[model samples]
Target chain A: MAENTAYDRVKAARANNRPTGKDYINALVDNFLELHGDRRFGDDPAIVGGVGWLGGVAVTVIAIEKGRGAKDRLTRNFGAPNPEGYRKALRLMKQAEKFRRPVVCFVDTSGAYCGIEAEERGQGQAIAENLMEMMTLRTPIISVLVGEGGSGGALALAVADEVWMLENSIYSVISPEGCASILWKDSGKAADAAQSLKLTAQDALDMGIIERVLPEKEMGKEGFYSVLRAELCAKIEELEILPLPELTEMRYRRFRALGAQQLAGE
Target chain B: MPFIDFFNFQPKNELEKGGRQSAPIAQDDNEPAKTCPNCHRQIPLSQLWGNDHCCTNCDYHFRMNSRQRVSFMTDSGSFTELYAGLCADDFLRFPGYPKKLETTRNASRETEAVICGTAKIDGRECCLFVMEPYFMMGSMGVAVGEKITRIFEYAAENSLPVVGCTVSGGARMQEGMLSLMQMAKVSGAVKRHSDAGLLYITLITDPTTGGVTASFAMEGDIILAEPGATIGFAGARVIEQTTRKKLPQGFQTSEFLLSHGFVDAIVPRAQQRKTIGSLLKLHSGGAENG
Candidate 1:
């Protein structure tokens, strides 16, 4: 299970058998009450959200669900969420802020849906709203990259106080194939593109884009969820102890300082 | 020439005819003519620039670099550039990225993809950040993000309204997730500025898509776009391939966005200064300016 190259990590990160967002939600939270709809649009199954119990503490849970199997993947749009999914996530996040409950998000998506309908419904606006709203959301929130963290689709859910990524998961601005095609004019060079993208969890950690890399030991097992649930609960409690303004300020600073050190050369 | 380029005579993007333009012309000739992809009329370069870069006959908006945009849109002597020193590093060391950056810097004659600063529109003072289409197609990289963030922070501190004109091909891929995080970073700054009760108007020009669209481009209190400019979350071709269907006519154009209520208005380049100035004045209440 050790991924040697960045491309290997990419493949491992996207392995079909790898745990998806739904798997994490099912394993991490208890008594999950699934919510639905963006109110302005129809509900999207790609995003599954509801209030759930994280170690006896009621928390809002949102995950980008890429269903398993052919039929299920088709139903879940292969985890490529449309605008409604993001809007639904925002609505839930806003509700969490209102109720003063902590929120947890499990992000996994190749990217946002690329169909005409998704574009017509304002996909960019939906994701933009999430980024802005989540920045100032007055409740403790943590996001875990349980699987592939595709560009804006994943970032929509990840503008959190703390972002954790699984050891093998990859976070990137563009898919390796996309980078390959754009840069080299050949999708076959995706492996080279993946290496150049610096998408592995370790690379993200080194760049200070993510806070922690969660161990995949005993992943998908009961022990893994137990440890994650406890860690998440403790982190939420720690964040909850801070004053609202301070918490929001720290969250803002965390992103504000990211990537500020480089580019000094003229 | 490659076989593909031989037949690829039409404009690659709307940057030419469908609405906006970026096709290259023979600049060496004394009387260089820019062929309007929309109207197919050959317009002299000096005359085109004199006409505010819009096609003389069809009024199709042409791509404007950040400097040209600033000069055309801002008051004669009111633009002060900020964050000009900030430039990108191939910290990821992606293959060909450093070389690409060097070549792009030389070609675009820009340190970064966006130029941020303070400017006045019709005597209304505000902060401005115009994306430079000539620089890597105005992609948002780490430095681009940093510049934008600092501009918003500066505007927030100074209590100045922000007028941003976005013309990007989205986040720069070479910078990886660092580029994507700029979306969040800039959004936080934008949110802070908005919370300060200052007006923030976004001017969407040709080819604003991807992370830029999904962040500050759509976060404005009032969003305006150029007519015929392509603006959307996903590219038109990607959507076509994914859906396996022909797109609806005028699918992601400024006019289409206006009809769909995503845009406040489709303002022509000639009318932008006046329109933006009027809005700034209207939004400049005692509470906001105070």
Candidate 2:
């Protein structure tokens, strides 16, 4: 196998054969109960969130599911959530907070769906509300970027006590093709845009945007699941010891410290 | 210079049909002018300023730049700008971006897109941030995000209310992921501010879209918008192309948002100052410890 460039990594992360949120949920979570609907509107299949047991610890599992095959993708909107999807996730998180259960999220999406109906139904408001609410939700959150983390759609679920990304994943504000189209008026230069975006997992970790990168080398499905489960168990154990006020304050400080370096010199 | 082309050029007819009616054009050597899209009448720059940048003939609200906005909303000489020293570096060194930034800075007479400061609205002290659309469409970049975060921090420290006037195209593409991160950064700041029980009001102006709409702009405690302002996360053209459907007229306008319960109110340009002052007064009774 050839070594992956940033663009190649993006392609691989988005490939249909790659492991998705559903795969991770089935592998790492036991006795999963899938929740549905925002209660205000219909359920969004793109966002699958529910209660589950992770290593015998009750946890709230929320993941963006891109779906398998054409029909599934159509139903899931290719992991690009609508407003209802975010609302559903918010409902699950709030429920988790009430129960004192830790929240785990799998982030993988091209972006939020930008259809006319989504905008009219308050897509931006939905995402913004999630960000605000998640900050003070009074529960530990661990978000893993399993694949493509594009723009605000990804960030909507990514405000966590800990944010990890798969080694092969790529996260950026805009997709490389979108960036190329906007910058050069040519989507063909996506490779160049990918390099400029600095969206690799390693780059994100170095920039303090993400907490850790889970390496994919020589790890079979079972091995990957075991490692992820151990990590989650350890993190939850550590977070469970902290007081709620302290945990929420730490989360707030973590976000407040981002982008301080660039502003320091000035 | 093509004298025959000058004679062939039709002005008012093309202006009426095109959406560039709000665009300022040099009608004469005396004063720059703009055509009111609603009434199709030429309004002089001085007259427009006197009318609070609204059309005198039909009361259509025109977009105001950050300095104009600050001057209009704040008491004279009461605005003390914070984080004016912060500017974006060419981290990516994208082609032509440096030159473009310089050009925009020289043209707009501002260092970055957003102006953050402490100001008074009708004797009520508050922190204010006004986005300048003329400066690269008021795009949020690293510096813009930093400034907004700093303002929120400042407001939280002093326990002052935050009043933001948003007019943005989106995140700046030149800065890549750094620009997009502003959404999270600013939203986090708004969260902190709100957690402190400080009042935060966002005044959505013309053409607020993309990451700005998806973040702090939409997180306001009392979301106010200017009458007839276009506000949405995605542009109408993009949505139309994606959905393959014709949108209803005034789909993303402030009126539409008010009807849809997204905005608390749509204050016209004339009443905006008074409305803001009234809100500040009403909310100013409580102490910082609340």
Candidate 3:
């Protein structure tokens, strides 16, 4: 492989694990400790959950994992979490409520893990349980999509107090290839389907599907950590003053508004 | 005893020299006759059932149960049902809803219209779901949505191809908005499954209508429909009444849908299994390499 090829370029860029979001949050906050495992079964590497600091306020963080290479991708299940991963996230979400800490999630995945083992392990029940549990989670939670945010894997995290996605990110129910195959019987028309499906950040914002869009220019891996850290700190500072009841109401209303289409009568 | 004497009935040609006394009964011309729905010929119930749910003369189509459909579409003994026990309760007190439920339950021996399961079609393992019109007129309700959602979720988790044999009158009227909510629920579930890069094919059957037609039924990765199947959203009468015009011939038929890009293929009943199996194999094979 050439040293300066596109793959190498992308690989080098991703090597900086301390993105702006993670770094700034770490430095500005204190006493951050991470948690793992679903307890019902095994732990999921795709979604990492734990108690972390934002300034002086404690918060729960759930992030979608992205492996650095093909081998790592296999290990991370290509960022698609199995049932145990969702279960682990569910466990942490409950803990966040117990300790009265706000939850923040970073979403970046193609979708949930699709494999024989995952189904045999009751994937449907797992996702259903997560949705049911999250619907009733008492703590205020926020989510941000740093990269590709495809379907329920993203929805698992995106259903929060506030949802944000970086510019250039895509959030869709299905990928263009899948849509094209269903509609045209030809996967080559994926580009056209992508245009029609309206899976971009701006399209989502226009449809009132999400709250905000984070600019991608200063959102590189290294820069993303700091920027996210700063944003989280500011958000936490703003949220700390609100009463629990208000936070609870806001969280409830936030999810209730998704996919609300314009009524014909209206 | 002769066949004519078995039913205590006389054969019309019993005395004819060349006519066999025990021959099958010949219809009497100008006599009180039950006209066949397809050919307008007088036929008995025994003949209709003996013809295997088809018009004896004109081959008119007949609605089938999910079990019958799966058998027709998959290899024998291949159906492994998913969410078999998900039944709807009378959550809302709609008038006569309980009676209607009881009637359909007794008639169809099923709790809901749709049955979701994994089956082998022409030797290819596939996750398939079939909707039978006998149960509650195949109306989509909470149970239908839950069952379908479970199917898609299972398909996505297993990296298996998903197939749906869709037939419905519309959303369940008793459930009202709850029924409407199922449109979103199933659509969302199908979307998630599709995003996982799994094959999701939909086979539209006769009388696919209303909210069912608007959502996941139309959102297939590859759509197919049975020949001559009626596939549309608005009822034929309602559309005609609203337009104040005569609709074109063959409107909303599977052939029409194929022409309008709503369906990929118009498959015959006997060939549906082979067609779907080939498509599944091709799609799954492609996925295996990647």
lDDT of 1 at A253: 95
Model 3 chain A poorest 10 in a row by lDDT: A257-266
Candidate 2 Cα misplacement greater than 4 A, ranges: A1-3, A218-220, B1-29, B286-290
Q: Per-residue alpha-carbon lDDT of model 2 for B1-290, expressed as tens digits?
A: 49987767665665555857575665565788899988999899888999999998899998888999999999889999998878877777777788998999899999999999999997789999999999999999988998999999999999999999999988887877767777777887898889888999999999899899999899999999998899998888778877889999889999988888899999988888889988888888866433
Top lDDT: which candidate number? 1
* TM-score versus the correct structure, for each prediction: 0.93, 0.92, 0.50
**What lDDT does each candidate get?**
0.91, 0.89, 0.68
**In candidate 1, what are the lDDT values of residues A151-196, reduced to their tens digit?**
9999999999999999989899999998998888999999999988
Arrange candidates by TM-score, descending: 1, 2, 3
Worst 10 residues of 1 chain A by lDDT: A257-266
- The DockQ of each candidate is 0.63, 0.51, 0.02
Which candidate order results from sorting by lDDT in descending order? 1, 2, 3
**What digit string (tens of lDDT, one per residue) describes model 1 on residues B5-101?**
8677776566655675455563555698989989999999998999999998999998888899999999998999988988978887778888898
Task: Write candidate 3's Cα lDDT for B1-290 as tens digits.
Answer: 68777677655564644556465667645454346555787656566556545556776666667887887778889899878877776654544567888999898998788999999998888898899889866888777877887788888888888999889986675543345445545765676677678888888888786556656677788888877788765566645643466777787778876775567888766577778888888886657434
Predicted structure 1, TM vs. truth: 0.93
